[model samples]
Target: MSVSEQFVGGDGVISTPIATGVGTGEKAEVIGHRTADAKPSGEYASILADTPLQADEAGVASRGMYSPLTSLCNEPRFATMRRGHKVMVGQNGWLERPGSIAKKPEQPKKAGFFDSLKRIAKEVADATEMKSSRRVKGGERGRASSRVRISLDPREQSLLYCELEFLLTSALDCYINSQFNAGRLDADKYKKVVDAWHQKGRPKVVGFRYDLETQLDLVFLHMKDFRFYGDRASVPAAISGILEAMRVNARALRVRTFCQPDSVMAKQLLDSQSLLNLLGSAEQRQIQLAEVVQFFKIVLEREHKLQRTEEVRGLPQ
Candidate 1:
């Protein structure tokens, strides 16, 4: 006889492309189901399709659970493509209604999107270790085989932006100044935040979602670079909202963000100088400076109210 026995059986104990090896054939391929119970399980199996291939009832159910066709889009408050823009909230259902047309603009719809994404991002902290897969757990690489998986979803970015907003409101000012990284968003702020994250501030999760971190860093960078809306008055509302969100952290926080008289035609329409030529109203930039100060006052008042509440909780009176 030879060093080993090799055979391939299709319907009967016949032959196929995999016949035999060379001299050192230390294995045997019993073409037929050598098991005592050779009856086929009712589960279907096809090489070309993802038909269930099972030898028992338990395996059949397991196949259905782990099938690639399983839907992960049944949750609510996740991202969905509505019209031309992405919608954020859909009742308790998170499934996408693809090909739906939008009648409005994305900017106007951003608030609702932001709210939904934030909720889901917070949900990421709860995902745990996934169960072992059949292929990696049964075949050559047994149960100890590690499974690595990565997915990039748009909702993660949206949720990250939510956290970034929250961080700006809650932690960035104190932390950034403490780390001495109060320039136009540099490594120092991230270093401080990451340290806090590892210590006690971060959420627990299943896997390291790199996209979330990347998106947060980009949002911070944009916030740091913002400077008076580049002297454009038409977009004053936009700049004002962002500025209200940002608080001065460092007494020595020195960053250059300048806006001159003649930057944009749209801005010129709102500038005091242009108004002087038109109606000779409040000159000497009083009108612009006054409005800016009023906006900041409102932000400061809201912040003070929050602090007052905090103080009251600590008092015995």
Candidate 2:
């Protein structure tokens, strides 16, 4: 019998069978199985399929990172289901979040000079053992958070695409290992952790000799769709980062127009508004930035008040 026609018989046995007379005289009901394709299709379907009673899939994702830890009965019945099924779709990395190009709120900048130094000192003072609560000052000027600023290198700001693909894989593993069994990680927490750990972040894509505009567009794309923003100040930093990365990539990739624009001379460029507008237009990430910045300002103000209250209750360092 031909291969196609050979698989025909009442017992579902087309190929050679272990038990020759048992079902071999019949037909091959199934094609493949755990050990071999000796089982019948009707029987195997029930075995492989996932039912309400059975929660795990007996297969691994491409990267072999994910698989369901489902139990048929879970000791007696659903034993907590803590370690759920894992399906590694990809690898590990960042997935750009959606953003807008909206209007930013009007707020004073962080500082004219010594920005990081001042902030770091304050944080250090607060967390340090050198300062005692008895001598700490209480109630001071209320400060508005206004915005969030993050800085990175000027080249290849975004994670590799393949690496990003793995984020799903990592995310799955993370979910599997996490205490939460809700099957999805908290997005806010994920961004905070990832952004905090993001190194080599910048605008330019080293060794990639693509169009300057296209490359720049991608930098904007990350802002518009990948990176998360918190406030007005964030936009500037994001813009700065992307622009700088592009410039850096330009040098390495031999692509023109990849370096930071002339606007980087100061905090706000000589033509600050215009530069902002240009980047905003290209990135199409303005709308969201504006909204978030306004929201963060309120949060910052609250923080400032809390700090003041604590100071008023004590002395100065």
**Candidate closest to the true structure, highest TM-score:** 2
Over 50-139, each residue of candidate 1 has an lDDT whose tens digit, in order, gives 122122223223432221111222232222324555446553334545665446555654445324433332222122122112136235
Each candidate's lDDT (Cα)?
Answer: 0.28, 0.28
Expressed as tens digits, the lDDT of each residue in 1-317 for candidate 2 is 00111122232321122222443334344332222222222211110111111111221222243211112212332222246455433322233224633465699777632243334333433322221222322344332211221111132112111222232222223222221112122223333333333343533211112234333433343343333222343575656664665444434434222232211211211122222333322121222222222222222334444556776887431
Model 1 steric clash total: 4
Off by over 4 Å in 2: 1-214, 217-242, 245-276, 280-285, 315-317
Displacement of the residue 314 alpha carbon in candidate 2, Å: 1.6
Give the distance in Å from residue 64's predicted Cα in candidate 1 to where it truly belongs: 46
* Every model's TM-score: 0.16, 0.20
